[model samples]
Target: MIHSVLESVMTANGIHSINRLHRLFFKLFAWGIMGFVCAQTAYAVPVDTKSYDPASGVVVKIAGKTLVMGWDTPEGSTELTLNLSGKGALVRSITVAPGNGKPVEVLRDIDPVTILTVGQRDLKKRGGWTIFFDRTSRKPSESGPLTLKLKSAIVRSVGRRCIVELDGLEGQSFSGKLRFTLYAG
Candidate 1:
């Protein structure tokens, strides 16, 4: 009888041990799945990027209308630089409109506007470039605030066109406008 009792107790203990092990494995699997899901959620892609650098610069002219600096941008690129002739005057305003009829100002601070200069020599360096517009000011009218229009154009293989608007000082005299358009392309 004692032997039978001992046998029963051993069987019950074995069963309990097996159940505990099974529970532990289940918990570990559940935790792993949860961790994977959390990681995926934390690594979502950004809706907009702050800057981009174009690999090349393309000169675009529209018959008698205006001249456009164009290039192909990477899939996630959002920013560009405009190379302008510093001979005339420092640029006061910039416009980028993808399709909208009105123009938009990309730059706001007056300090950086004074840094742009003439000739390709100075423009080659990235320091001469400035931020004109970004995703923050993408939709001016929709935001219900008075914001500048961002206008740009994509033509064939040339990609999109970025137009820079200039405001010169009253007494300042420049030979011509040398504008450089830089962006992530």
Candidate 2:
């Protein structure tokens, strides 16, 4: 029935080839549908669905705030938090690299390099998962994961947050990016 109707429209328009008319109809139909959908969604907010990388599972936050590595931020300053969401997902490694390729340094006798701390956060659970970095190894200048002394068993599930405390000398600022990889435990 539709083919006959198309043939009649083609005949009326002096178009003889049914194939050409069919193709033209489909093309115009597709364009009309696309235009309608675009017009409907033009005012909608764009969403990023593929932001989660394979290695990072679901990166809740990436460098939330700019942090100066070698500067002594006041006490209670916002600690860097890496929010992860996955079942049985544990941090396999965290590698740090300088943003400018220069080594992250905290010069002694010039700047105050304060204490650095990393902790496993499960608000529902108690506080048995905190690790303080050794003062000697606190000056990270290259790309490498921390040799965590604690066992890797902290699982980040729903409603949990992992926090790391970073502070260093105040003289020269050390800026860097940290990459964290996770694995199913």
Candidate 3:
């Protein structure tokens, strides 16, 4: 019935080839639907990744406020937490660009988001970020994940993004984009 209706419409438009016109109309219809869907969700799409252990949990507290973040079982594994302080929008986005052309991960909430970026947020108070990392390696000098317990850190916006300068026990320092909630009243 649909094919007959399409054929009648095409024939009414003085088009002799029904097969070619049918295919063209179908392609146009599919493209229109795709375009509409993409446009509706273009601004809401943020690159994210949440493939981590579900048993781990992070508890974030600043002043009297407390927020529980996602899973991260860092026990027995090298757990490196950076006490970051700086100026930017207070956000619940945690991202790590493991360097070496790695795909950035957005570990946003307690669920999973991996990569955090700077955005226009309404920050109420001034504070810092305490970020955690699972060190894949033992030594800081090695080219893998390093274990460090650094505190009193600060994040400075160098250019397009904001980064927190990291210094470990081995005196080796590295920079990474760390954006999270700064709730110090």
Q: Global lDDT of each model?
A: 0.38, 0.34, 0.36
lDDT of 1 by residue, 9-51 (tens): 5687866765666677799999999999876644411211112
**TM-score for all models, in order of appearance:** 0.22, 0.22, 0.24
**Model 1 / residue 5 / CA error / Å:** 23
- Estimate, for each residue in 86-158, the C-alpha lDDT of model 2 and write its tens digit: 1121232233334434333222112112333433433333443433332324444333233222111122222
Provide the lDDT at 57 for model 2. Answer: 26
What RMSD does each model have against the real structure?
21.6, 18.4, 20.5
Where does candidate 1 stray beyond 4 Å?
1-13, 46-54, 57-185
* Candidate 3 residue-wise lDDT, 1-185, digit = tens: 87887778787865656776779889999999999987664322121223222222332222211122322222211112222222222233554433233324453323212322222322332332322232324323333333333333333332223233333222124444334422211
The regions of model 2 sitting more than 4 angstroms off are: 25-95, 99-185
Off by over 4 Å in 3: 1-16, 45-185
